[model samples]
Target: MERYKDIDSDSGVLGYEINNDNITVWFHGSARPYTYSYASAGSIHVEEMKKLAHLGNGLNAYINNNVKFKYVRS
Candidate 1:
């Protein structure tokens, strides 16, 4: 996996990895990662997540508000 970019967030989302079908997130103080996908979060949400991930803002909030508990812990 690629290194996660540092971002400003209050959701404990330390960083993330984007891929063709999934977004894997690394949380602060957590050893395991979580993966969200189109099947879980929908394509629109996934796209928004990609943008937020690139922007280093809003990704954590978006996940909490929209897709919380919708990801697979890995």
Candidate 2:
């Protein structure tokens, strides 16, 4: 997992791991990670998430606005 930039210091996301078909996100104060996969979050959302994860910014807000509960597991 790579640390999330949270460039503006306004995100709950702490870290993230991106895979070809999924993204695992770790949030502040959370003991477990949220895994959003193509099957659960949809290919389009997951793909966009991959880009956001790599950029290290806006992943949290994007998840909140788009796929918050679309995670396959936690």
Candidate 3:
């Protein structure tokens, strides 16, 4: 997984791994990674997540505002 930039230091996200159709996010104080896939969170969310992950900002907010609890697994 790639470490999250958290440019503003206000994100709960600590790291993330992007895949063809999914994203695995690791949050602060979490021992497991949450998986949000195209099949679960939908292609739109997954795609947006990939971009946010790369940008190192807004991913946590995006998840909270849009895809909360949409992960397939942890």
Instruction: For residues 9-64, write the lDDT of model 2, one tens digit per residue.
Output: 88899999888898899999998999999999999999998888778788888999
Q: Estimate each model's TM-score.
A: 0.80, 0.91, 0.94
* Winner on TM-score (2 vs 3): 3
Q: Candidate 1: how many backbone clashes?
A: 0
Q: TM-score: which is higher, 1 or 2?
A: 2
Q: For candidate 3, what is the TM-score? A: 0.94
Model 2, C-alpha of 7: deviation from truth (Å): 1.3
Query: Per-candidate RMSD vs. true structure?
Result: 2.3, 1.2, 1.1
Which portions of model 2 miss their true places by more than 4 Å? none
State how far residue 39 of model 2 sits from its true place (Å).
0.2
Q: Which pairs of residues collide in candidate 2?
A: none
Compare the candidates by TM-score and give the number of the best one: 3
Model 1: how far is 10 from its true place, Å?
A: 4.1
- Residue 44 Cα positional deviation in candidate 1, in Å, after optimal superposition: 0.9
Q: Model 3, 1-74: lDDT tens per residue?
A: 89999988999999999889999999999878899999999999999999998998899999999999989963
| Candidate order, lDDT descending | 3, 2, 1
Off by over 4 Å in 1: 1-11
